[model samples]
Target chain A: MIDVLTTAWNWIAEPLQYGFLRQAIWVSAFVGLVCAVLSCYVTLKGWSLMGDAVSHAVVPGVVISYALGIPFAVGAFAFGFGATVAIGYIKSKTRLKEDAVIGVVFTGFFAFGLVLVTKIPSNIDLFHILFGNVLGISRQDIIQTLIAGTLTLAVILLRRKDLLLFCFDPNHAKAIGLNTQMMYYTLLSVLALTIVTALQTAGIIMVVAMLVTPGATAYLLTDRFDRMLMISVAASVSACVLGTYFSYHFDVSTGGSIVVLLTVFFVLAMVFAPKYGLFAQRFRQRVYKKQLDEMSSPP
Target chain B: MTMTASSLDITVDDISVTYSNAKLALYNASCMVMPGTITALVGPNGSGKSTLFKSIMGFLQPSQGKIRVGGFPVQKVQKRQLMAYVPQSDEVDWNFPVSVFEVVMMGRYGYMNIFRTPRQKDRRIVMESLERVGLVDFRNHQIGELSGGQKKRAFLARALAQEGKVILLDEPFTGVDVKTEKRIIDLLLQLKQEGHTILVSTHDLASVSTFCDRTILLNQTILASGTTQEVFTEDNLTMAFGGLPISSLRQMTGQMTGQSSHIVNRQTSQNAEVEA
Candidate 1:
């Protein structure tokens, strides 16, 4: 037992010797926390598809930023924000529903990004941009991610109550003079920034999972928004830390490992949650049915 | 608790609203609600009742004309916290993870500081509002756990906590039990006695004459407006309901009245008194 324990400890401690691995772990945890916090709002507001659309839509912006020798986040945020605006504009202008508009706009932007990737010089690594390279992330990219993530976190925390009211009932929010339009734009902008923040850690293809899975898992476990927020942060941060360790040992993708863990947690919560889970619902129904049978038996 | 009487009245002057899709919702709609009175805005399903409410609350900008509260512009009145609105049940997400207490606490948002941290007074008022709606026991329960009537009562508690001089409720009685309906009517009457101006939009015509001091029959525009006794006539109701005869209208009210023995007795007594 002592030998096994020592081996496990060595496996954990050996990675800390490398500066890049240490930075990767810290960056992963930070990105997980920021995405998890915003995920609560995204899940509750029924904006999961919006998160997906915005994340995928940032690919062209990253390519453009690479071509122009500028910061990737600035260009990525612009396109992400622009995608949301275009979706809104088109939905208002045409008779199409929001989901259809989101589908068309995101696909068009992603296809345009693919074409740009093919035509650009080979200096840019398309694989890293699509699937993330957190283990090999640079110091500058880390700083950019942290700054964007912190700003998004601050705005969400400061305006938490009004945003909650807006998501729950926009009409009532307006009735209370809370400026629902401003709240709408604030939420959309922060969502765009959050996508940009997660881009370096989770990449465009996997970032939507980072933005949606934790909150969905937390939602199943609790019936209070405050508790839900805390649970999501805890779940996501732990997933990031553990998934990075596992990925290092197994030589696998870090973002993929973390998202897989998040999905597993969501499934566990869905099946076994105390109050609203599938098992609990079935258990309640069975008990009620037994009582009915007993009563019908001439008691 | 005695509420200070409000002397403010609501006036909508020839307001017209057109949606972004070029759908004209309301055209030249106008009405006046007096303070210290309960006025009913009666209309059909697609008759722009909600659009009118939105215009009055300044949620939708009217293409022409204006709305004023106590001789002040709608925007200025809103800034002064002079209005509270209760939208229909379908307008909210029931599955949101907010407690009944938290939902009612939202009414005090206008009174909170920048952080929206509730003061002791806000907590006390939230409790009092819950008590008023008889949902104090369910304060900590998630809103989705509540029954249909309980949900309506919770929203009513929120409106009560708002402490706005002018209250507009759209379809407050729909999907509620008779007991809850009685509770709502009683609360509205109490607010009327306190000199608050109330505008309630509902298709439930039976109860309009039971308590409302004035009624505005609406079908795209004001079909009739005056005291309930004058405007709630069979002809005006027929026109407003799109040619439903007086017999079916009475039957609708009668079927609704038959749901509760208490309301039936009171309605019969009131009808006998009217006949006498």
Candidate 2:
């Protein structure tokens, strides 16, 4: 057991000396951090389904970009953003329900991606875009993640009020002459950009888990928006570092390891955090019921 | 668009609204809100009070004539600095993760440049508006923590931050406790004193006479509108509620017996009078 552990340690420690591995670690950390921040509002707004929808909707763009050998992120962004805008437009102009719109657009995109994947079956990197390759993370991917993360932060900080109003009391925002359409698209675009940055290191499936779990876990800890974002980032960064380390030592898929790491953190938060955590919530309800019985019976 | 028409009044003339569901919610609604007064719009359920309020607030464009706010046509009066709206409820996602102060600061959106953040003056206005609503301590509290009444006050604070010449409220008192209701009414009265034109939709007939300067009674259309005393007459009340009176069906035939418009059952007519 000691020999096996030492071997595992040597394999992981060796990668630290290489620039490529360093870039992979940096990229994952940035993606995790940005996603954690953005997820605060997303979770609060009960749009927890957002990461699932937005990430899946980027499928067709990934297929097209790969087919044409173009910058995949560009195609993915435009298509992701286009799909988001289309859903928003349909929601605005038609009386159709939002969930129906999301389902139709997202499924259609996923199907298109699947078809592309089938066509490229024999390739070693065939489904790499979906599962990701954190082990093979590149310098260009790191730059891409960094730039998108920075831009996402900048936009959120700058238009904090407009975005807050748009999310909270949209009718009042409209009545006061805020262009609802413009604000809607601006948020969708930011969502698209955030997804694109996350697509590289964590990829589609695990990236979504990373995006949602940390924020949800953090939500168990605080009720303030700014603090929620901060805690989410902290949770995500911690998960990313731990997951990367474990992936290296265990000789497993980094993407899968990262998702597992995040899920564990979320479970811990659910059971342990104060007040609204899952276990605490149930326990509190029991105590409150007991107190009510004591007060009401013959009193 | 700003309502710079040298008057602070709203006038809806020959306006009609039909819902997308093909129901004519309003039929030729018309009224005038004079300057510097609180005009209470009252009616029974399904009445066009909310419809009229929506038309005046430019939320609904009428199919017929126009509704002007402060002499500025509804289409042209889309200026944030001159007009603000208070909804009955903040039904938007409470999970939106905004503090009360952040929500109120959004009132300055129109005055801001496309990429601009809130100015110091704008922040000050938001702070004062929060203070006005007695939610200064809750400025940094997440919206999810607020009770229903506090939620309404937060919205009102957002409107107050607009510093508008006019405020249009839609059933603003719903779900609010009586103490909070009175505080809101007091705040509206204060707004009136500041020369703001206030129009509010209400279902409470009892409170109209006490606080409102005038009342517009509507039932799918304008039934009667004028001072509270002028509009709440028995004749208008009958028309506003409906033509049939329950007393006509009551066990009393008393004096309404033989000289009535139609005949009653001969056997029950005498008993009805006795039971009267």
Candidate 3:
């Protein structure tokens, strides 16, 4: 047992000595934190599909940025915001529902990105943009992630109460003189920024998982937003650390492993959480039933 | 503490609301809510009652005309926190993860400066509001755990915490029990006595005659609006609820006659009745 433990320790610690691995871990952890925090609002507002839409829609922006030889964040944010506007415009212009509009717009952008990638002779790796290369991230990528993550966290914290009120009841928020329209766009901008920060760690395809899973798991565990935020952060950070360690030891894809670990956390929370978990709720119902039966029976 | 009451008069002038798809929800509707009175807006479902209220609250823009609150435009009065709105309980997400206390405290958001936390005074007002709605003991409870009636009271408490001179409530009596309904009526009466103007949109004609000083019957436009005794007649109700079964209309008119007579007897000393 000691030998196995020592071998595991060496496996994790040996990767910690490398600068790339250290950067990868830090970036992934920060991405996890920001994604988790924003996920609370995303889930509460039923904007999960919007997160997916924005993340996928960033693909064309990234391809176009590379084509123009500019930084990817600028292009990514523009396209993400553009996609949201397009969805809104289309929904308003036509009778199509919001979900249908989102599906059409994102798939179109994603296809356009694929065509652009194939037509361009640039060295931009479509694989890396889609699946991420966490272990291969450079110092610049790390700094970008750090800055975006910090800004997102600050804005969310500063406007937590207002944001919560807006999501819970937008009409009431507006009636009370809150700039609900501005807040709506601000939330979308933050989501775009958070997705941009996460791009390097989870890539486009899996970033939605990182954005949604941790908050959903925490939601199953708690009934309060503050506690839900704490639980989401803890869940995501731990998953990042553990997944990074295991991916280093096992030589697997870091992003894939991290998402797998997040899924595991979600499943556990769904089954075992005290109040809202499946088993716990059934257990309480059974106990109540037994008490009722006893009360109805002759003594 | 003594409640500082200020009467606010609302004048909705020739307001017309059209949806993005060009559906005319409200067509050149107009009404006047006098200060220090409770006016009930009664209509069938989709009769533009909610649309009118939304336009008044500045949530929905009117394609034509304007709304004025206390001599200021609706938009300006909203910024000054002179109006409070209690939306129907169904409009809110009950599963939202917030405490009853926090929801009530949201009413003070307009009064707060950006980046500032709630102070002692805000907290005291929230607590007082909760006490008024009889939800003081449920301050720490999650909002979703409350019964439907409790949820309505919780929103009422939020409106009370706003301390606005004008309150607009949309369907507060729906899905609530008798006790909660009574409590709400008592609170509205108290607020009216304290010199606040209130407009409630409801489908309950019985409660309209019972509690409201005036009634507005609407069907995409104002069918009739005046003192309860003057406007709640069978013909006006028939105009508002078109195509109603004759038997039910007869029963409804019978009930309206009984209530209108009671209102006439009660308002004999006052000359507040008006025809529309």
Clashing pairs in 2: A44-B95
After TM-score superposition, what is the CA distance of residue B79 in candidate 1 from its true location, in Å? Answer: 1.9
lDDT of 3 by residue, B1-276 (tens): 235656889988888899988889988787888888999988999999999999999998899998999999977887888899998877888778899998999888888888648889999999999998899999999999999889988988898888889999999999888888998999999988888899999988767778899887788887767787777665566667877864585465457654564344322414222234
lDDT of 3 by residue, A1-299 (tens): 99999987898789889988888888788889999999999989889999999999998888888889877888999999899989989998998899999999999999998998999878888889898888888777777777778888999989888888889989878887888998998899899999999998899998999989998999998889999999999999889888898898888989999999999999999999999999999999999999999999999
TM-score of decoy 1: 0.94
**Candidate 3 Cα errors over 4 Å, as ranges:** B1-5, B246-255, B258-276
RMSD of 1: 5.1
lDDT of 2 at A215: 77
> Which residue window of length 10 is worst by lDDT in model 1 chain A?
A171-180
Clashes of 2: 1
lDDT for residue B265 in candidate 2, whole number 0-100: 33
Winner on DockQ (1 vs 3):
3
- The per-prediction CA RMSD against the true structure, in angstroms, equals 5.1, 7.7, 2.9
Model 2 Cα RMSD, Å?
Answer: 7.7
Q: Write down the TM-score for model 2.
A: 0.82
What's model 2's lDDT at A259? 84
Model 1: per-residue Cα lDDT over A65-179, one tens digit each: 9899999999999999999999999998898899999999999999999999999974668888888889989888998899899999999999999999989988777777777
lDDT per residue as tens, model 2, B204-245? 665666689877878887766676555654545556666547
